[model samples]
Target: MFFRFACLLLSMLLFSGVSRAEDPVREAQAVIANQLSAFASDDAETAYSFASPNIRSIYRSETQFLDMVRKNYPPVYKLGNYAFGRSKLVGGGELVLQEVLISGEEGQDWTAVYEMRLMDDGSYKVNGVRMKRNTTSEGI
Candidate 1:
């Protein structure tokens, strides 16, 4: 029941396109999807643009950032499938927690907790992501 409610709330946030103009869930999804799509298409520039300012600073260059993602987040770069799930608002909506179900190249199952941050442009960017491999009897 809780999962259903959370999914519904996230769905509302995702489709409403700036719900109340205060919630940034839609922007978060857009940025994440855009970056991932860029990765799939090998478009480093577009993917780097979706990252938060802090991430941009850390990576310092598009090539550097793209290499890091290709090396560290292979699943996100080459996913078999993915879907957004529950989301939680934090820091009065400045930050958000988004759950993602991801299947990797070899069909490895993972749950990604995406940390989203609202930017000055009235949009959201991906701040960080932590992935956990899901262990289940029924393999993905």
Candidate 2:
């Protein structure tokens, strides 16, 4: 049993390291997905932790940040499903712009463009999001 536990621990450590080595686009998308999951459970602190320093500076507190998201971004705050759309690196690879096509809880389609900035600690954080109502019949 001890040998089996050792092997499992090693595998977990290796997998965790490999996950962080993913490309910038995937990394940014992962951060966004994590934040959305946090919102689904109303985990304000976890959701706010994914925000960039600039955003955190403005919001100041987790409650305030979560409140803003709930008020201004209903689709993201309560999503049914989401798919990754277009993605590109900007600012000389320091930033990733990713488009997420979301189906809201109320069945409305929306597009959320997220700007993710690479922080000094080598993690990407959500800098901002620009959301627009999908006027077309396209589905994600």
Candidate 3:
């Protein structure tokens, strides 16, 4: 029994090699992309499913959440094209930022900071998202 257990452990460790950097980042990006796809399809219920438990609690209803998104994050609702920029570990969680280029505009750039957290089920969800655009600083 002891020998079998040791062999299993060794195999597990050896096969669980995720040393490359892009693996985790690519997984995270895929999650965000899928969730965003749900949004673009006007599937509010599906989009809400991707949100964290805390966010779901606050929003209460998918309709309310969709309304809020349409009102505040129109770019996200009507996305032209988006590209994943960078992702990093932050505060025991992961932060992934993406730039969404709005369509039908001469020059518009919007960057969204997506805060993701690992859940108890070993799945990641979006804790929150903050969007900002490019603008010159007048005076700070």
Q: Which candidate is the best by TM-score?
A: 2
| Candidate with more favorable, higher TM-score: 2 or 3 | 2
**Clashing pairs in model 1?**
none
* Alpha carbon lDDT at 36, candidate 1: 81
Worst 10 residues of 3 by lDDT: 96-105
* Model 1 per-residue lDDT tens digits across residues 30-120: 7778878899999999988888999998999999999998899888888778888777888777998887788777778877788998877
List CA RMSD, all candidates. Answer: 10.2, 5.1, 4.9
Between candidates 2 and 3, name the one with more favorable lDDT. 2
Per-residue lDDT of 76 in model 2: 92
Flag regions of model 2 displaced more than 4 Å.
1-22, 135-140
By lDDT, rank the candidates, best first.
2, 1, 3
lDDT agreement of model 2 with the native: 0.89
Ranking the candidates on TM-score from highest down gives 2, 1, 3
Q: Estimate each model's TM-score.
A: 0.79, 0.81, 0.72
Local distance difference test, per candidate? 0.81, 0.89, 0.70
